[model samples]
Target: MDLTTLTYIVVGFTFALYIGIAIWARAGTTGEYYVAGKGVNPVANGMATAADWMSAASFISMAGLIAFMGYDASVYLLGWTGGYVLLAMLLAPYLRKFGKFTVPEFIGDRFYSKTARVIAVVCLIVASLTYVIGQMKGIGVAFSRFLETDYTTGLFIGMAIVFFYAVLGGMKGITYTQIAQYVVLIFAYTVPAIFISLQLTGNPLPQLGLGSTLEAGGGGYLLQTLDRILVDLGFTQYTTMEEGNGFNMMMLTMSLMIGTAGLPHVIVRFFTVPRVRDARKSAGWALVFIAILYTTAPAVGAMSYFNLINTVKPGEVGAEASNLLYEERPDWFKNWEQTGLLAWEDKNGDGRIQYYNDGNEQFAQTATEQYGWQGNELTVDRDIMVMANPEIANLPNWVIALVVAGGLAAALSTAAGLLMAISSAVSHDLIKGIFNPGISEKGELLSARLAMAGAVLFAGYLGLNPPGFAAQVVALAFGLAASSLFPVLMLGIFNKRMNSAGAMTGMLVGLTSTLVYIFTYKGWLFIPGTNMLPNTAEYWFLGIQPESFGALGALLNVTAAYLVSKVTAPPPEHIQHLVEDVRVPRSAKEAPAH
Candidate 1:
């Protein structure tokens, strides 16, 4: 079958499977909706968590970003997976032992203060909404590119699918669907990686092949060749250090790490398992799955760079670089062209496309004169790299179809989880806990479904008018998480005296400072041209960009919490006992009867 037919088949069948799972595991009570009744096996929950966390960014954009940005992209790799280590070792087990259905529930009961709980709720909402915006946008971009639909229409379709499973089954349906999604997405992600690795390095594994010799240049270090070609084309070496200010890169990496730890959608996944030990084990398992992608990405980037440069060099295909015609474009080039992702212009009268890093000072003049080029005209978005790679490598049509399913799975699974978080907060924390203390389980479940529907509408609207690229807005989400939610949870667990006053004050301070910093540089909510920073060195704080400031925000949060706590009376003995109870999971009782 052809690519289009195969895509419809694969995506259609996967949708059918998900819908089937939703029907099978439909939520019947509030417990099922909120926590999947806390009955999921550790391994299954771990796989589900992996699917919920990966998203379109992992399956579609991460390799592409690594391919183009080279070393600068390491921050994403380290920051995202490293957060799992913190969650596994520090946060997940304790939260699971506390045995609450949602994150806010734990915070509220732990502090014995409804106000503290509300502040925590606000922090979760901000982090989750920002995070979900990126996922919805990713879904829209994927559908528009592959399904041949407009972005807004694609978003509505995606939202409809999410609503079908999420509103009906809640976390129970979401968990099984996510496990299925994990299987599909991983296969989708790795199949292309394997194909590309074999083509470029004669190795089947992308991770090992990245460090292997370059098949394109006969026999040379792949990274070394990429570095040389990039330098020749006015770009930086793909394997070496970046020339951007050292402090800024350091700050940026740190910020991404804290933000990873702080994200609400990811943290809430840990609460679904049965035991504290299982929660910790599940976090480790999630990391194991994530690492498979992280380890292979750098290799994919190196090989792709070499492949891209080989396509541009003169005399390779018996065609003049200056007179190459559009009809003769490679299949990968033609494929992406249909999606409007790859474009070219003969700026220098040279028909060949040149896409160097645009950072090599030594070759800058040569680039301008030899090519007669004003600037690079190729406009391939970073999100296209992994999604389009199978087509790029001339893989089978079925593999290409798998790619489409994989992208959808990545986006939809995460969306389901995020919606679950939003709904649980509304129904359990806000309604049952506060508004209607006598509410029945059935009534709470009804509220959860309504909240899910409303949240999806709000998120779809954001996707229709995406503030920026998915990854860029996601960074802001991480910063918010790092600064606000992470510190409060950490102090609440490990420290005995972190009272309601301290946790409350710290969350506000951290939230405000991080938001102010981001708004100052990214504009109030990332609207362009309204920012206070020059968006350049002249206005940066010690050369650090606002995007890389989340780590500092986390520091501010911990500092504020500590300072405020010391000035106030210590938390009551009962709260300290709660902390102790969380640590010793073996001594626990069953979750309080609903």
Candidate 2:
């Protein structure tokens, strides 16, 4: 079958699988809807959590960002994965033992105030909404490419699929669907890497293949060869550290680690495990599953970068024979052109494609004076790196179809998880918890579904107009979570005297600071014409980009929370006991019934 037809089949099959799982796992009770009745096995829960955590950002955008940023992109790999350890050691088991259905439940009860829970619900909504925007973009991109539709139409289709499963099944449905999604997404991700790895190196494992010698039998390491190729094209060395960006990377990593730990969708995964031990074990399992992709991402990025350069410059860099004739480009190049993601202009009117660093003035001068090249004539969008990988490698059509399914899986799984988090916070935390304590179970469930539907619509609308690259948009979510939610959760559990007033003040401070910083640079809530400052590095506060400002905001949260708590009354004795109870673990048989 042709690539388009195969893609339709594979994608249709995956959607059927998700809808089937949703029907089988549909929740009948509020307990089932919210926490899967707390009966999930540790390993199964782990796979679902892996799917939830490794969203479109990880699957579609991370490697592409790495392809361009090189070593600087390690912040994402290390930062995102490192948080599981923090979750396992510090948060997940305790939250599981607390036996709460939502994050705001834990915060409200622990702080002994409805106001605190309301604040938490707000933070959860903001963080989750920001996160879902990226997922929506990924969904649109995946659908747009594979289904050959416009972004808006693709987004509507993706949103409908998520609404069917997410609204029908809730957490119970999302859990099992995510498990299937993890399998499909992980398989789809690895197969392309394996094929590309085997083509470039004798080694099959991408991790090892990155360091292996090129298949051309040169003694030079693959990374070394890649470095030489990039440098020859006037780009930075592929394997070397970039100057003046180390601090930004470190701070960004810190933000992602803490932000991940604080995210409500991920934290709520623990709530579905039957026991505290299961929660811990599930986190470990999640790490193992996630590491499969994380370890391979750097290799994928490096290899993809190398492959792109190698394709454009087939002979020697800066030589006329190396350049691809614009009129004679490959089918893959022409394919991406339809997406408007890949473009070429004969700037020098030379009738050839010159892919080089137009940003480097010195290189442009040399190219113009010596090589008869005007400037960089090819513009390849970074977001298309992984999506275009199979095509770039000239892999079979089925593999290409599988990649579309994989991208959709990643985006949909995470979007469902986030919508669940948002809907739960609204229905379970705000509506049921504060506004109407006596709501019927059926009413609450209906409310949850409606909230989810609304969230899907809002996110789909934003997907039509994204703020930046999908991964960069996700970074904003992480920054907000780190600055606001993570600190309060950590303090609420670890500090016995933390009161509602202090926690609320801290969250407000953190949330406001991060939002203000991002708005000043990115625009007020990412409106196109409202930015107050240039987003350049030179305009950054202390050389930190808006994306990296979360670390500073988190520090301000800690300090403000501490100072506020000093002047506030300590938690009442019952709240103190509640904290201690959650802190200690119990065996399955001995654990107090929720």
Candidate 3:
């Protein structure tokens, strides 16, 4: 079948699977709707969690970013997966043992303060909404390309598909659906990688293939070959990171870690497990599943770099009389060309395409002497890396269809999970817990569904008019999570002395500081062009870029909490017991007992 037809088949079949799962596991009770009735096995829950956690950024944008950034992109791989290690070790089991429907429930009861719950609800909403917006935007982009629909129409269709399963099934329904999604996404990710790997290296494994010898360079190491090829074309060494700031990289890693641990959707996944032990085991399983793609993505990037340079350069450096002109570029090149992602300007009046390391001083002079080029004419969009990979490698049409399905699966699954988090926070924590204690379980479920629908609409609207790249939105979401949420949850779990005053104060301080910092430079909520000043490497604090400042915000939160807690009274004895119980999975037998 053709690419478009196969794409429809894969997408249609996946939608049917999700809807079928939703119907099979209808949420009759609030517990079922919120936590999948806490009966899911560790392995299944782990797969579901993997689906929930690996958003479009992981599925689509990560390889593209790595393709361009080289060694610097390792931070993303390490930070994203490493944060799950932190979550599994420090947070997941405790939260599950606490037997809470939502994150706010643990914070409110553990701190003996309704005020704490309110604060948590706000943080959850902000984090989930911003994140959902990112996922929806991803869905729209994938759909527009694959289904051949307009972006808005694609977004609406995606929103409707998610709404069908997420609202009907809630957590119970979404769980099974995500397992299938994980299967689809992971397969799609690995197959192309495996083909590309074997094509470039004798090795079939992408991770190993990354460091393997190149076929084109007569047994030279792939990285070394890339360095030579790109350098000859005016690009920097492929393996070495540019000399910018190492401290900022460290901070960026920390921020993503804390932010990941702070995210409510991921935390809530633990509660789906049958027991506290299951929660811990599920976390371990989740990390394992995630590592599969994380390990392979770097390989994909390196291979893609090889392919990209080869595609652009085409013939040998000295053989070509003139470079590829704008009119003579391939269909793939021209398609991306229209998006302004792929640009070729005839600098120095040369008809040839000039793609190189424009930022490297060493290559600048060599490029001038050799190619007579002015600059890197390659204006390829980073988002196009994965989407264009199959074409770059000359893969079959079915693999290409699988890529679309995989991107959709990644986007839709995460979006559904985030919407569930948002809806549950509004209905379970804010509406039912605070606003109307007398509200029935059924009423709350209805409200939650309505909230999910409303959130999807808002996110879909934003998706149609996306703010930035998937990775950019993902980074911003992480920064917010680290700054606004992680500290409060940590204190609630480990420190019994944290009272309402301290918890609320810490959240406000952390949230305020991070937002102000981001807005001061990123413009009010990152709309752009309204910054206090241009964010330059010169003006930052100790070389702390806003993107890498989540760690600082987290430290600030912890400090604020300790100082405030020292002045405030301790939480009640019952609250103290709650903390101790939450720390142990063995004592979880009676948690959900009737």
Q: Against the hidden reference, what TM-scores do the models get? A: 0.94, 0.98, 0.95
Question: What does candidate 1's lDDT look like per residue over 98-151, in tens digits?
Answer: 778887888888888888877877888877787788888778767876787867
Q: What count of clashes does model 2 give?
A: 0
Clashes of 3: 4
Q: Per-residue lDDT tens digits of candidate 3, residues 1-594?
A: 877888899888988888898899989999999999999999999999999999998988888889888888888998898899899999987888777898888788777778889988888887777778778767766776667776677788889999999999999999999999999999999999999988888789889988889666589988888777766665556778768758888999999898999999999999988777788899999999999999999988888877877777765564554356656767667655544445777777767676766777766776677656677766776777887788778899898888888989999999999999989998998888899999998899999999998988877765654456787678877887898789999988888778778888888888788878777777864566878967878877788877777789888888998899899788888778767766644442555521
Q: In candidate 1, which residue pairs get closer than 3 Å at backbone N, Cα or C atoms, i.e. clash?
A: 255-551
Model 3: ten consecutive residues of lowest lDDT: 585-594
The best candidate by lDDT is 2
Ordered by lDDT, highest first, the candidates read 2, 3, 1
lDDT of each: 0.79, 0.90, 0.83
Alpha carbon lDDT of residue 157, candidate 1? Answer: 91
Off by over 4 Å in 3: 315-322, 338-340, 347-349, 361-372, 465-467, 584-594
302-346 per-residue lDDT for model 2 (tens digits): 889888877877777667777988778888888888877788998
**Mind sharing the TM-score for model 2?**
0.98
Ranking by TM-score: 2, 3, 1
